[model samples]
Target: MSVVAERPVVAEESRAVRWWRRPWVGPLALVVVVFVAVSVPRYLTLDPAQSLVPPVEGFAPYYPMLVAHVLFGSVAIVSCCFQVWPAFRRRYPVAHRWIGRAYVFAGVLPAAVLATVIGAKSPFGPVARVSNVLLGLVWFGCTLAGWRAGRARRFGDHRKWMVRSFVLTISTVTNRVWGVVAGVVLGPQLETTFGGNEQYMTSTIAGLTTWLGWVVPLILAQLWLDRRPKKRARAAGRSGVPA
Candidate 1:
């Protein structure tokens, strides 16, 4: 057996893994995220009664807050899909810049603010309210840091912070996923546990999901980022240049 003959299989395997990680994996996940984000807006507009907002009385503030959160959040989520697409980012850098600007300012900032306010009034109770407040603050902080890094010409720092921000932004979907699972598992026990009060059970579950949803995904992303090589190093390797 020759060394060169044995190496071809290794090289082919490496290429397959790279292709899966790049175009296939990222694009497929992006499609799912974009689909969910786009579908959510319809519930906000077309099916308000059947939407996530609880039908509590004295709907003075909750209604407006829900609307603002949904609209701005939808904008942010949709914009994020384009911003993170590797091909779009590379081909249309200028468009990427503008989309990111709109994402941070018009989408994330307003949505986070509204989320904090709405969370305070959650029918579930103080636990969920506190979770919302924390999530909102962290989301806003990550996005602002990302924007500031870009302004300071620290592209690496900007990219890291933006990745964190986008993870938090996409947590809306994760949160819902958790919520559904919890509802299904805890459905029968809710009445017995919470004195048959749907509101109390709802509040408890919301708080639990809020913490688990975003925190777990952010942790996973951080681990991936820590393991991944720096972009400059990757480019250097590709170009046969020293890093």
Candidate 2:
């Protein structure tokens, strides 16, 4: 077969085996939906001066951290949202690489650093602090791995690492999810209506998000990556090929 004829076949096969088609779409869509749902309120209700947790000073801690949070958060969200879209990956490989780099440098690094530093003094508790730090580190690692994988042309590995990166980045989405749910369900009534308690609601929400947000991605990654060897071994056993 001519190289040109084989190119499309190779690309199609690659995308089919990319592994984001099953079950990954659900959580990624959920995060997007949640992001659109809460973003308007977050912007309209912007008050960067207040502390979601503590270690409050003037603008020293809160503002810088929040700025980093929003900037990096935006990169992470955008990168994650498009990482699995094959059309985008193929049609805009250069753009994808650029965005992916931005996600690592602009998003993952700052988010990890600020999350670690700010988490220590959070009013949410030790569990929340630790979870945030851990999430930050993991997300950073994911981005780094994605970068390395892409550099080495390990495209499948790149896709997997990017999936994990986006999953951790969805911590923001998770935070907002619990914040909204807690307000509607768990919060005390204020004159038979909700009013101006977002920060309070999100206090513990951050920790819950950090810990639980990763559960889906972790399980998916383990199944996707690790299950292959087991499956092959079982087939080998049945065929009596080896071992």
Candidate 3:
């Protein structure tokens, strides 16, 4: 009798395991955690002196609004990490829905409203103010759209809009990263270009990074969204399924 060679058996990976193994998921979670840890504590002290953005001279409510905005924004960003986690959504769908409700109602709604108010009167000057206002508006609109889509049971649209909102929510972290990069590049030129006026240098970097932080990520997200359909279509073709 001839001996036949047998193929090695391979086990399929679980959805939860696959999600954890994704290249971007762990790093993204770590970045958000680090950002929240570093940025939230100072605000929690509830001292105006510890405010990241200095209070405007004539704006009596600046500090309060800033505090509210930061706190609510913190909620949005933290909840968003869970909202986007595929494993969490797949394994614990009920928890996912409740968190999603919290993210929308308690997080984005109040935060986005406060963002607009604070941004409109921002002490960072015209450029930074404009960027902040626009960012707030877009963030609010995308979130509202996402929430509506979810309620309507249009999950595909919900996912796309929520992805947009999540990216905007995390743009705060990206803003800091860009701020550091801008500082490194512009710090040396402060004397030559800004006449050693630290305020002017600071404002310029803030304005530039504020725009870059959200816009760049948004553009990348749109590109990814656009390509997803093509990827699905190609996969369908390969599998002899209707696209």
Candidate 4:
């Protein structure tokens, strides 16, 4: 009857008819990029001295650790891509279910390893340690929360948390994206700021942005998506979508 009354119907129908631009594609491309940019090179070239961070306790004998690192990194990269299937795309609960388990083991687990590998460099400034710890917590916390929410049969909450987790996990891929940009743009200034590890810092900054950029934005997105305007649900039911 009014513009307000007509607005939602138009929005909903428009949303339903859309294609060619699903949210999953961005992350899918990210997964591929991670493999190409980070994983492949790290694998083909196994030099402990060249590793971006110091070796962990078990990750010593850099060769083996590097191999494992590449392996796990691959898992985290791939897992984050499939983590969001049922929503905004054709539902693939069957793949999502199995992939969900692998994600926890692959994606979240390797991140835990990175936490150790990258240890707290408090003297090097808070960014490295803080980022490492926070990244691990985000990866673990989000995945766990998503799992628990789904187990409780709260689908909406589950989806939101899972999206949050996947966003955090994808920071690995995002790190590379930012790393290249910063190095290309700030190549000379890096040695001045972080000593000689300018490229390393660029990479680190990129990885961290995956959290600062994608994950945080995702949380804001969830809040925005969840904010139903209070009246929309009732209106949707009245308009025949059955809420």
Candidate 5:
């Protein structure tokens, strides 16, 4: 067969083997949903002095950190929405690389550093502080790894690591959702656990959610990636192709 004829056949086969039809559409929808659901309220309602857990009234660094976290995190979230879209990646590889660079350096890195600082200042105690630091470190490291992989031209590794990093970044949205649920469920028990000190009770809840929010999404991503190869192999076998 001629190379030109084979090209279309190969492209068609690639599309047929894909995990989803138009995967970008669903995720793009989700990206918008998450922005509306979490990011909007976060900035709109932010009042440093009235912050529930950290109580930012007396702090200087906290203000800058808070601003950096919100702005840089927004950049990361929006950049990732484009980064993961198949149409964007395939049709605009140059743009993909640029956005990925911004996502890592201008977005995740700054956000994670500021987060570590803010987490260290947690008013609740050591538990919240440790979780925050750990989460920030992991976020920073995963994003850096993805960038390095892209530079090395290991595109598969780049995608996997970038997906993992994006999942961690979006924990900002998940963290808030979990916090609301915890507040409602644990409202009556605040006095029982913290001697009626609402500040400490809020602190405890924040600390727990900090760990749960990032950890859960990462675990789910790991499971999905691990299954991907096996699923692809099964598909290939059914099609009488060598896995």
Candidate 6:
């Protein structure tokens, strides 16, 4: 009798497991968590003096609105970390639906509204003010579009719009990162060019980064979304499958 060689068995990974293992997911989630941890504590004290932005003249509600915006934005960002997680969505679809509702209603909606109000009176100068207002509106619009797409059972469009919304939601974190970088690079020039006006220096950096933070990432996201179909078609062709 001839001895037949047996093939080694390799268990296939589940879809959820595969998605969880994607390189970007864990690190991105961790970054968002770290951002929340670092950025939220000051606001939690509810002291107006602890506010990041200076109070605008005659705007008594500025601090209150800032506090609300930060808290609600924290909710939106934290919840959205899971919202974009394919593993979580694939494994617990029911929970996903509920979380999506929370993300929309309890997080983005309120946060965006307050953001718009706060942005309108921002002390970061006209450029920063316009950037903030536009960011708020676009963020709100993307989230609303995502929710409507889901309601209409257009999962693909829903995913795209949600991804856009989430990117906008996290732009604040990006803004801070950009601000720090710009400060480091620009700090030495403050004495020479800005006449030691820290507020002016800060406003300049904030204005530039506020635009960069959302605009750059948003462009990259749109490019990715546009290319995704081409990538799929290529893969399908390689596999002799119809896309």
- State which candidate has the highest TM-score: 3
Error of 4 at 132 (Å): 0.9
lDDT by residue (39-112, candidate 4, tens digit) is 56655667656655555554345456446656665666676665654343344666777777777776576655
Return the top candidate by lDDT. Answer: 3
The 0-to-1 C-alpha lDDT of every candidate, in the order given, reads: 0.82, 0.68, 0.89, 0.63, 0.81, 0.88
lDDT of 2 by residue, 8-114 (tens): 97887677755465465667667676665555334334565343444455446665675567666776676766666665676788888887788788878787777
Question: Best to worst by lDDT, what's the order?
Answer: 3, 6, 1, 5, 2, 4
lDDT of 1: 0.82
lDDT value for model 3: 0.89
Q: Which parts of model 5 are misplaced by more than 4 Å? A: 13-47, 50-53, 56-59, 191-194
Every model's TM-score? 0.77, 0.68, 0.92, 0.65, 0.85, 0.91
Question: Which ten contiguous residues of candidate 3 have the minimum total lDDT?
Answer: 1-10
Better of 2 and 6 by lDDT: 6
lDDT of 1 by residue, 14-82 (tens): 554553456654764676567666666656664457566674476576876777788888788878877
lDDT per residue (tens digit) for residues 190-232 in model 3: 8999999999998999899999999999999999999999998
Question: Where does candidate 5 have its weakest 10-residue lDDT segment?
Answer: 48-57
Model 6: residues >4 Å from true position, as ranges?
1-13, 16-20
- Name the better of 3 and 4 by lDDT: 3
| Model 5 residue 140 CA deviation in Å | 0.6
List of clashing residue pairs for candidate 6: none
Rank the models by TM-score, top first: 3, 6, 5, 1, 2, 4
Q: Supply candidate 2's per-residue lDDT for 6.
A: 81
lDDT minimum window of 10 residues, candidate 2? 43-52
